[model samples]
Structure formats: C-alpha cells, structure tokens
Target: MSVTQADIDSAATTLSTVIRRTPMIASRVLSERIGCEVWLKCENLQRTGSFKPRGAYNRISRLSDEERARGVVAASAGNHAQGVAWSASSLGIASRVYMPRGAALPKIAATKAYGAEVILEGSTVDEALVSARAFADETGAVLIHPFDHPHIVAGQATVGLEILEQMPDVDAIVVPLGGGGLLAGIAAAVKARRPDVTVVGVQAAQAAAWPQSLADGHPVAAASMNTMADGIAVARPGDVPFAHISELVDSVVTVSEESLSTALLLMLERAKLIVEPAGAAAVAAVTAGAVDLSGNVCVVVSGGNIDPLLLSHVTTHGLTAAGRFLTVTATVSDRPGGLIALLELLRDLGASVVDVVHSRVADDLYLDEVQVTVSVETRGPEHQRELRRSLSDAGFLRD
Candidate 1:
C-alpha cells in the first residue's frame, strides 16, 4: 500500500511517546563550509542511537494481539537490529534478530542486551535475511522487513514532520540513503507538504544501490557492498521505499570513503557531534560538493552507533586526508648521532614526531646508510610542505 501524509501523521502520533524528539539545530560551521544556512537534524541522538526505533516501534506496536503473541523476526547489519530489539522489549514481545556475522561487536552486544535473541548468521545483511526469513517461517513469527513495510516508512516519516516543525524556513533536506526508508519517509513528508523544498539523498560510493536502482526504475542489487559506513551498506533498496524515492527525492549522490571519514571527523571536531560514517553521509555530500547547498539546508545525522575501533581508524584516515598527519622516510648515515641530527632538525622544523622506526640492514639500504621512518603531526598541508622543504634543505634524502 502507498504511504500517505495521513499515515505519516498517524505514525508521528503513535511514536510521540515511544521515541525521542531528536534535535534540529543550526550549524554555523557547516553553513560556512557548505555555503548555506546549514542545520543538523540530529537523529544520531534518538532512542537506540538512530532513527530505526521510530519505525520499529511504530510497526511493532500496531501488531494485533495474535501477532504480538506470535512475536517478530528481523535481519540487519546493526542499527535496525537494535531498534527491533528495543521495540520488542518495550512491548513485551519476543524478538529474534539475525545479524551479519561481521556486524559491529558493539551492535551485537547491544541487541542482545536489549533482550533479543541475536544470531550471527551470514557475512552480509542480505545473507542474514535468509536466516531471518527461515526463523520467521519456522517459529510462525511475523517478519519485520527493515525498510519494506508501509508502517515502517510511515513511522520513519516522523523525522520529516519534526524537521518542518523545527525549521519552517528549510529549503532543502539531505538524508542518508540505505535501503531508502529514511530518505523515502522524509521525501514523502516534505514533498507532500512543500513540493518546492528539495529532497536530496546521499550514499557511500562503495555500497551505493539507489543510483543504479533509480536508473533501472527498480531496486537493483549492488554487486558488492564495502565501506566504513557499514550501516548504509545495503545490497538493494526496498521496493516500498524505492517507490516513494522515485516519486519524491530530487537527487541521489554518492560520497567516497575519504569524504565519509572527513565528514565524521568534521562533525566530531567542529560540531562536537560523534557521528557514525553512515550518519555523516549528508555532511559528506555537502563537503564533497556532491550536492547543491545553495539554500537553507538540513542535513540529517542519521545515527551515532559507530564502533570505537572503526572510529579510531576513521580518525586517523581523516587526519591524513586533512594533511594534519604525515609519515616520511629518510635515508641517513648509520652513525649514533645521525638519528639525533635528524630528530633535531624535525624539532627545529616544529614537527612533533609521534612514532619512529629505524631499519639498518635492508636491501634498499647502503652499508653506511639507514632508513628512518617517522610519523609526525603537522598544522596542515602547508606546514607539511614546509617540513618537506626543510628536510630537503637539510640534505636528508627523502624516500
């Protein structure tokens, strides 16, 4: 069934007490960077740390007495699992969540902590769906499709209602596109209310499906999904959400891994927001110039359920991309004071060495020469260039 404004409104009403009204705040930093009056719809702060619970709770709460008794089953990479688990726990329903074997450890633990029977079944969400469907059939439980159900779409649409209520002057809404639930929900709500306002969707370049799906006028399966933004790395878009997207979304754009990392770091450092890679997709699009930010734009930070290890790696990647960190190898004389001289030079250049490695006996090294690799912190790209120039002027052979 087609989701309408009334359905979305009904969802908002149903979810009013079940979900948190996530904040929509102005972001001067993003505004200056994107050349617009940028606002952040911080769904990252929502209950279950995402927008997923809105849909999960809305759909689960509507289950008939018989259906609730039968319980529910679902598959997800991470976010949706937590949502369903939390919703079922709240409603006193037994829930089983089939998650990818490689799903984030924190997510798996969180789902189980929320009282769902967590089963790590496959390597990808699509493969996990096979197990979830089988479980539903075996147990006679209702299967909750993450983004395919009308109730789920209607529920996720509440975010759009909040956005319009929170920022009436908003000229555009940028959302992260995975299976297309969040984008479709927002698009339907915004387009139905104010067709002039643009609705843009962003996806990770490595795992994007909507671009190809849109081209084929159907849900096209991506050949492979690989990216740090694992939350949005769906193999295919949901048919239900795809229909809304096809009718309402203005544009779909893809952002690179580097861009996603950079955006996550930007949110953490500048906006003081701890955003996951998927949650940062909208910001990535704006920073990467993948979308037009000519007017008052609202970028939805969809979730903040990133694993600590992934966040650390993304932080390093972001620093490297920003040119604030550098690794340089230099050939030096194999004397005791040779390393001292090099380090002194680096100190003089105002470079803080974070790590150092020395290799004396190597195929590439001469008998009298040693290879010294140093990782250092710099002010930025210009400071990095200055350090390189200093090293060159000091007669150190850079490798």
Candidate 2:
C-alpha cells in the first residue's frame, strides 16, 4: 500500500493527542556555518525522546479491536521499543519488544518502564528482528515493524506536515536515514505539496545503505554496519522507503563517525541541546558541507535517546577532536616536588588539568624517575600546542 499526503494529514490529526508537536528552532550557529537560514526540527524532545511514538501510536491506534486483543510485537535497538511500549500501554494492549542483548541499558529499562515485556536477544536489530518475528508467529501477535509498513510510513509523514506548516518558506529538508520510513514519509509529504523543495537524507558513513541502494536502483545490503548512531544503522533499506526515496529524495550523503560525535557535542555546547549521534547526522552533513546550502533548510534532529555511557565517550572523543582536551605523558624526577613542578609549569601555561596519574613503577622509569600522565583542558588546538611547547621546553620528556 502506497502512502499519500492525505494519509499523512490523517495521521497528523490522529496523532495530535498522542504526540508532541516538537518545536522548530532557528539556529544562528548552524545557519552561519551553512550560509543559509537553518531551522532545527527538534524531534529529539518529542514524546518518548524521539519521533517513533508518532508512528507507533498511529499504527496501533488503527488496529482492529480483535487484533489489539491479540497484542503486538516489535524489535528495536532502542527508540522504537519505547515508542511501541508506551503506545501499547496507553491503548490497553499487551506489548512485547525484542531488543539486542547489547542494546543500551537505559533504553531496555525505559521500554520495560513503559509496561512492555522486554526480551533481549541477538547482537543487532536485524538479528533481534528474527526473534521478534518468531515470537509474533508463535504468539499470533501483530508485528509492528520499525520502518517498513504503509501505516508506519504514513504515520511518520506527519512530521513532514508539521515541518511544512512550521516553515512555509522551507526550500530544503534534511533528515537522518535509517530504514527510510522518516525520510520517505517526509519526502512524499513535502514533495507532494512542494515539488521544487530539495529533500536530502544523511546516513552514518560506517553504516550507509541508501546511497548504494539508490545507485543500484534497488535496496541493497550494506557492506558493513558499525556506528555510534545505532538508531540509523540498518544494514539494508526498506523497499517501501526506497520507492519514495528514489522518486522524491534529491540527494543522500554520509558523515564520518568523527563528524557525528562533533555534531553531537556542538549541539550540546553551542545549542544547549542533548542530541544522540543519529539525531545529529543531518547537522553533521550540513557542517561537513555535504548538503547544498542554497536556501532555507530545516534539519530533523531525529532522536535524543542516547545512553549516558555512550554520551560520555562521544563527548570525550569530540573534545579530543576539537583539541579542547589534551593528554601528555611526561617523565620527571621522582623528587619531593617533581609532580608539583610539572603542575606549576602547566599552571603557568594556563592549561587546566582535569585528571592526572603519577607512576614510578613503569619498566622504563628509573628508581628516581616518575612518569606523570596529565589530561588537561585547553582553549583549543592553539592552546594545546602552546602547552605542549612549554612542557617540552621545560625539559620534560614527553612520550
């Protein structure tokens, strides 16, 4: 079944009570970088911490009473599970979600908190999908696919409707590509109304499938899939979304893992917004100059449901990439004030030490020699360089 603008509009009205009409904020920082008027569709702040609930609720709401009684099953790495669980709980339907065993602890807990029976299996969403399908078959429960069905596409299209209304002058729409439901829905909805508007999709370079799929004129499996943006790490594109993407999407681009982490950190520091790596893909594309910055562009920040542990690692990587943090191992004398002298030198260089470890037991260090590792916060690349230079000039052997 094909999704149409009318179906998306119906989805909008049906989902009004179940979802939040997330804000579209004008971003001066991103606009300056892209040389265009940029607006961020903050779906990260939506109900259930992502846009998944919109589709989940809309699809489940349309189920027949008897089907609802039979219950629903779904598989997700994270966001979709919470969406289905929350929707099922609200509709008085039994829900069981299958998730990868390595899925984020917070996401798994969140799904159960929303009143679904969480089943952990497999190592990836594709593998977990197998278990979910088996469970659906065994229990005679209706399966809610993450991004393949007509109802899911139509439901996700509501985001396009809201974007159009929120930015009538929008000339380009950038969204993160996963299984393609969100991109296909938005492309179909927006292009149906404004054919001239450019619709772009961004994918993680490590897990991109849409670019090759589009190249071959059919859905194809990715060579490999590894990315911190697990939300968009589908190994293959959905045929349903591929159809809309082929006809409507103007361009698709991929961003590096470094850029993804940088984008996440930029959103957190510059915009004061917490965005997952997947949610920041569109921004990464724009900042990396992958998207054409010719007109008013709105980037969909897909979801904000990131694990805290992952966020911590991403943040550190981002800081290292931006040269805001520096780690240096310096061999010094193991005298009474050896470390203090090193600390005084760092203070003189104006680098704030965030963490330090003093070691004298290393094989390379002599009895009177200590190796000190210092993690320092700097102004940026230049400050880090200056700090390194000062340490080198002070006779500290850096390794």
Candidate 3:
C-alpha cells in the first residue's frame, strides 16, 4: 500500500477527466507577511468544491465491474461524501454515504444532489464511520474509506504532482491535516521526487491531534474547542497516514480559529477567492507563525463550501481582528448637537458607522449625557486610532 510517483502520475491521468487541475496561485500580500513566495493551491475550486474528489475518483475508478455492480458506501462529515457520491455517480455505481448529524447543510445538500443516498447518522464522523462499515457489510457494498486506503492516498498525491509541475522550485508545501490522505499523498510524491522540498501539515488548534499525538508517541485528541474548520476536526489521524507523516512530514502546525477565520476572510476579500476554514488552515498557520516560511512556500486551499450565514460571521470576525472594524462606547451630551458633532468627527476621519447602540439611562452616562455604543469600519488600526483621536479632539469622551 505504499504510495509512489507512479501512483501520483496514474492518479493525475485518471482524474484529468473527473477532477480539475486546481490552480497554483501566488499571493504577494501573503508572501510579504510570511517572508516567503506564497502560492495558494486552489483545490477549493475543484470538483465538489474540495480535493476529496481526487482520492474518491482514484479509488472508485479502480473498482472491478463486479464491485461497481455491488456499489459503494462511505462515511464523512461532508467533503468525503460529496467526493464519493460524485465519483460513484460518474461510474454509474449506486452510492450510499453516511454523515454525522451536525455536518454542514451545504455539504449534505451537495452530496445528495450528486446522486447518492444520503444517510444522517451519529454525532461524530467516527460514529458515522462505524455505521457505514456495518451498512457496507450488510449490503455487500465496497466501503470506500475517506483516508485510510492506499488508493485514496495515491489519488490525493495527484495534488502534489500538480504542485511540483506548477512550481518546480517550490521550497515548501503546506497542507491541512485531517486523517492525512492529502498529506500522505503529497508527501509520497514530493519526497519520492524532490526530498529537499519541505512538506508541512497544518491543523486547527482546536483539533490538533497529530502534533499532540506525535508528542505523546500515540494518538491523543486535544481538548474540544469551537473552530470554523470542521473539515480538519478529526479526533485522531489515521495510523497508516501517521506512519508516512512521522517519516516524511517535515513538521505539523496548528492555527487558532481566529487565525483561520481571518485567513479565510482575507482570501475572500483581498485575494478575491472563497476558502472554507479547513482549506484556509495552511494560510492560518502561516499567519500564526507556524512555518519557518521565508522562501517559496505553497499552501493548499483544500475547499470552499462555506455556508452563507457562517460566511457573514467570518467576515465580521476577520474585520474585527484586523482592526478594520472597531467597537467602542462614547458619551455625549443629551443634546441634538452633541450626536451630530460625533458624526462629524467620524466623517472627518473617513470612518463609516456600521452599528449603534444608544442608552440614556445607563449609570455610565451622566444625566445630561447619552451613551452611544458605536461600531465603525476604518482602514486599519492606524485609521481607527486616528478616528479615535478625532473624537478626543472634538471634545467627545469615549467610554
């Protein structure tokens, strides 16, 4: 079950018709921040909106005619299910996918839309996987594992092949780690071809199992914390993938939810790209000072299927983090001219108000003063500070 360059080449050829040759995009803004030639591998633009199709198609394409007739079953949070369903549909095989109940709605809809029987089960991917395996045993369908199979690993290696082909002299490649299909595949190809290039894996800090498990010499999940990167929220890395990771991966890094959301929002706004939290983990890691990035480093953006509601929140979160948006309270005299003066001050600083909360009864405000809670958007921290200075100069006291 060893992955090789031949496996990658085969995967690339097989997936040519099924999957996209995801773009290798360079980001000057990110490059300057990380002091590296930052290139973003846009798997977010791939079929099924993620790199999962690469592995899924590779595994399904190898099925025997008898196996195809028998059909395929898989368990996933969302991406793997969509990948399997998409691949199976193309091969005219009946596909059944099990997903955790809390999986994203968009992923669930997309997978079902791809012509698969979607089954919601359990509270976690691990639990759904158990159910999927049982269902496969009962139905005589092939169980297509998300990341623990050789075919899947070989398929994911196609991403690495594409990276090297796109940027032959890339100094490092950063990938988000889940069960490690992407990392194992990329490591296999990159190490087999150019061992000198570093291959690093990034994980959500809230789900940093690999590094902690490696530190303990065994798999041990981290404490639970909310993260936007659900695609990488694996409780543990696959044993097979961990072996390759141990030997081939240069290092594993973890980035916080704040960092991931910030990066995701940056991709959407500045880079003019939409990236899901898991897909943005590599960039998040770079922003969080994970990689020793200083040369040409390529970050794999693995997916872009974020829900619209969540996207709205992430955008605000990012703006707040970068100091482009500020929230503060000001107390002005309870007179019409007082509020107008504050508005004039904001206008002078070129700040736009986003929200306002008013209270006349708060003890924080004098009987003759009104407390106004303001959320304003500015250019950056400097602009925000300048705006605050304007308020001070205008004789409006900030609370």
Per-prediction RMSD in angstroms? 1.3, 1.9, 2.4
By summed lDDT, the worst window of 10 consecutive residues in model 2 runs over 390-399
Is candidate 1 or 3 superior in lDDT? 1
Clashing pairs in 1: none
Q: What stretches of model 2 exceed 4 Å from their correct place?
A: 361-368, 397-399
Q: Using Cα atoms with residue i matched to residue i, what is each candidate's TM-score against the true structure?
A: 0.97, 0.94, 0.91
lDDT winner between candidates 2 and 3? 2
- Tally clashing residue pairs in candidate 2: 0
State candidate 2's TM-score. Answer: 0.94
Please give, for residues 71-98, the per-residue lDDT of candidate 1 as tens digits.
9999998899999999999999999999
lDDT (10s digit) by residue, model 2, range 373-397: 9999999999988888888988786
Worst 10 residues of 3 by lDDT: 218-227
What is the lDDT of every predicted structure here? 0.92, 0.92, 0.87
Whole-model lDDT, model 1: 0.92
- Model 3, 117-183: lDDT tens digits are 9999998888899999999889899999999888899899989888999999998999999889999
